[model samples]
Target chain A: MNDAFILAGIRDVARKHVGWEGPIEPDMRLVEDLSLDSIKLLTLAIEVENRFQICLDPERDHELITVRDLVAAISHQISDTQKPEEENSHRDTEDTE
Target chain B: MNIASVGSALPPHFYDQETLLAALRANWTQRHHNVDRLEALHRNVLVGGRHLALPIEEYDNLKTWGDSNDAWTRVAQDVGETAILRALEKAGLGVDDVDALIFVTVTGVATPSIDARLMNRLHLPPRVKRMPIFGLGCVAGAAGIARAADYVRAYPDQVAVLLSVELCSLTLQRQDLSIPNLIASGLFGDGAAAAVVVGAERRADGPQVIDSRSIFYPDSEEVMGWDISESGFKIVLSAGVPEVVKHYLGRDVDAFLDDHGLSRSDIRSWVSHPGGPKVLTAMEEALELPDGALDVTWNSLRSVGNLSSTSVLMVLEDTMSDHRPEPGSLGLMLAMGPGFCSELVLLRW
Candidate 1:
């Protein structure tokens, strides 16, 4: 479900900027398949940051090679950061019960 | 050709360095907590003040990037026309006398381009050739001159005009929190500059166009670039920019001078683009210039920050107004930009 949300966000930006008419999937190459230049990639990164409230370092992250890769990475990051909150909420429910 | 004259026009709105810094700090705080270091970095830029097309409060209301681009176009036309008129008047030439027009900018894009707009506005001849160059960024001024010289070299009886209008303030990214964006906000300002380049065989007035060279550094693409985001144009000014200059400019300058059969010591005047405080310092240290060699560049930076493409032209104008290099004397104009490239123009007065 988180992956879907992240993919939706990336697809929205890519479509707006590059006018991609086809389905956006994991293996889609941002530069080659989507015809996204360096400038467009930067724009996509900015949009992703604003939408997901996540910071991504363009230089450090190597797994974010494709559109699917970006979505997966973001989904992983969001889930990792949210797991503690989910556990805390569960603890609160148990105490209330 | 030697810069016959230079004219600069800033918007009416002006703010003192302290006031600007205060506003910046306030903005930074609103975005992130404890931005003391960012404020200090702003102070270290050595910019005293700058002119803005609109008030700071109005920045938020600039609904779309198109709106800001339109505002830049309006200002560009007004100031660009004024500067070009002054340059032509100083050269004792009319619009009809100009055979070619070169407009340089990186801040905004237009369908007809700024040169086409100016051609129609100024009543330039129908056949007046137009070459509008974009993506050169700050190096456009020196590169514009070099390109103009190339045009005149081929047609030695025709005159060319190079106009640079940089409304960098319009490219401000409201949501960006990067250090480069913050520094760019404090560094670049709005301005336009025009130069009239006449061929040696032409009867018009100006210095002779001696030679020019452009050197592109390898694998240095990350030094500086523009990232076009929805927020606007986000600047990618790497911290290594000053280091790049320090590491390469000395050898590049030597190579440039060597090709012209002259040494750095033989050049009388240096017209360098005032990119920023750090950039100016790096160039100074690398070139080992004497005291006051870069006073014009420094003063231009303090007065107008880095006007991007127009910044070097501002220095060229100041040099012409104050120093007026002696006849047969040598002068060098240098500028660097996005390609991590340097454009050097060797001039003889």
Candidate 2:
């Protein structure tokens, strides 16, 4: 749910799925610095989705260029999906009260 | 030398991308965790469907290299013959007219070679020059055209036919779960294509070869190729392929054009091998092509997947039949393959 957790998830995805043993800094570009091709990026997306159990909108792939961008996107995706359930819970509590 | 015609043949069996992906997932999911990776990889190649040398169910019967290769030889002869005959027919010629026969393929091997075997089937001249080129991989389409051009240039009165038969499905490594093998399983398909090239003195209504160039990058052998083992050919496709294309293709093409008093803007047609989506995108970016410049190539990739050496020839065939450019327009046929090499053939319609 947090940035650190998402960042660590991305690192694992990069290393395990993409075979990148180098350091994955926040500023490192996925294609240029990390050498992730389109296939690698897709693999990373799926692996990250499995790790975090959240669906990533491939439509937003263009906006995710760096490790920081991916971490932020995952965080944002988690928050966006959580908001609906959170709102439903609040509505249910209010009805009960 | 003029390319009088191009003929292509896909096997009788065809399957949509979804079916193919399902088959692959079923095969790989047992050993592979996250079988979704296979799904994503198969879907992202942008191939709508593909043809297999045999029916999908029959592939399971091929349990060894010998078995698959035997199928390759049999089907290759059939498909290759059809392509050659079609090409010759389109050129208004017959088997007796072919002075040179060049056979190119990386998917399988043979002792007497397909060209040699086809002599009895097609009933060609006994003395017809035969050249069986192996291991060019994807570049053999352009490279074969270049070599045929060379032959016709020397003979000046002869006709040359280049046949490329790539049954990529036969070369699949079922046991290997390597990244390259996974990608290859999704990206490549089965097909054969033949190009009829006539000499300068011959009368043919088609694109003429103006010039050709071959460029080999050092220390990049690991970029894209195969690693042959007892099982069969294991693909060695690295993620560095697009990088190689981005780094070299544009500059090499520019220089080749410069030598002939032309530029990128002068080219009206771009007949390129559809390596995959990323390779095509890298080509478009590196060449600074206008939008839709590779529309035909993309269409071919989508319809049949990448046919190895036959891909560019199929693109050329489409260009000739449907997407024909205006008279006096220029075209370039190019492809990159093993040896981490590229072959460029300049043409004029």
Candidate 3:
């Protein structure tokens, strides 16, 4: 998946689910800039997990301060989970050939 | 009427936040989707430690709500007796001096209630009037004091003792995995408190009750409370608690103060309940409080978590003992609870 695609997904969740009217940016702090409270932050976490089909560690949420940090973490989780499936797909393709 | 003394008794079984968190994680790890979410929620409450009415291992044996209520009945009497004794002793009064006994709690129920049960144990006079309040939740601490003050105001020669025993830990629903229950588990604790309110005719070395006000928000029953079931009391906490604080607290407080020819600036001491981090933050923001105004409450929350109705009294005890303000300064004691309501009590030292 593209990083821009992940960023757009995050922006959509923030805007629609979290009710953030302000512009979502990579450097914008979720708490300080976007003004997402703890509940909203939790909602964002769950919605992001469902959207990406990847599990996010809520305990490590403190490490995700900015939108860029969140996007990067989600991207990392997606890539890691997709690796095995991608390898299996390649094996199946080669076997078919 | 004056607040003669405030005394508290915490249960013997104490555990740090990490230990409690570990125990909860172990219990919920199998069923919970993400254990990390539980840990994060617990850490966010910022409670350093809490006292439990029962031993940690003993909790698993509580198979039914009846079992929990039985434990609540046994422990409430002990703590309630001790708290009342301590408060009466501090006020240089005795059981015979207490003309009225008002008990407030929301954690559990007993047929005769804890206050009536304590009458025989504490040797309180048979003639003493008993008022057992149920379902007030956290606001009972401040509201209890206000009621005690009202009692003394009516009698003018009597002493009213208010006892609040909240065993919040016993009400924990192990089967529930909702966010509210998780937060409640992390936030609430177990304790009991008693306050001595003396009539104007009596002499006491403490703050005089100036006035009090109770404001209830209409159509907000779902804001915070307990949903009772055959199993037990499930927590009905809402994330919108902070929002409610932001919306109503400042205006209510300002109007309350204005009625007594005072303003927010006139209150030198703020003795508030330690609801939680978010509620305290919202309170500070709504009231536009000065730096360190609610430091005592914050410290209490960090140390003992929230003891439901007993918490504000613990804060009051701490304030009167360790953080006593100026001799003639004005103070305000406030708390919010399940009624989606706030109670404010003004005091003069």
TM-score of each: 0.77, 0.85, 0.86
Scored by CA lDDT, what does every candidate get? 0.81, 0.92, 0.91
Off by over 4 Å in 1: A1-97
Which lDDT tens digits does candidate 1 get at residues B1-349? Answer: 4455566666777887788787767667665433554565567788888888677677677778888888878888888888889889888889898899999999988878888988889999999999999899989999999999898888878888999998888898866765567778888888888998877676644456688899898887877888887756778876566777899988988998997778999988899999887788889999999998899999988887889989888888878777778978888899999888999998777
Which residue pairs clash in candidate 3?
none
lDDT of 1 by residue, A17-95 (tens): 4457788888888778876644356556655665676656545454567987788767776777688999999999999
Clashes of each: 1, 0, 0
Model 2 — TM-score against the truth? Answer: 0.85
Weakest 10 consecutive residues of candidate 2 chain A by summed lDDT: A38-47
Arrange candidates by lDDT, descending: 2, 3, 1
Q: Sorted by DockQ, highest first, which candidate order results?
A: 3, 2, 1
| Top candidate (DockQ) | 3
TM-score, chain B, each candidate: 0.96, 0.99, 0.99
User: Compared with the true structure, what per-residue lDDT tens digits does model 2 show for residues A1-97?
Assistant: 6788788888888898789999988999999999887767876876787777677776678888999999988898889889999999999999999
Better of 1 and 3 by TM-score: 3
Cα lDDT of model 3 by residue, A62-90, tens digit: 89899999999999999999999999999
| lDDT by residue for model 2 (B1-349), tens | 7999999999999999999888888777665555765677688899999999999999899999999999999999999999999999999999999999999999999989999999989999998999999999999999999999999999999999999999999999988866678888888999999999999999998899999999999998978888889999988877787989999999999999999988999998999999999999999999999999999999999999999999999999999999999999999999999899999999999
- Candidate No. with top TM-score: 3
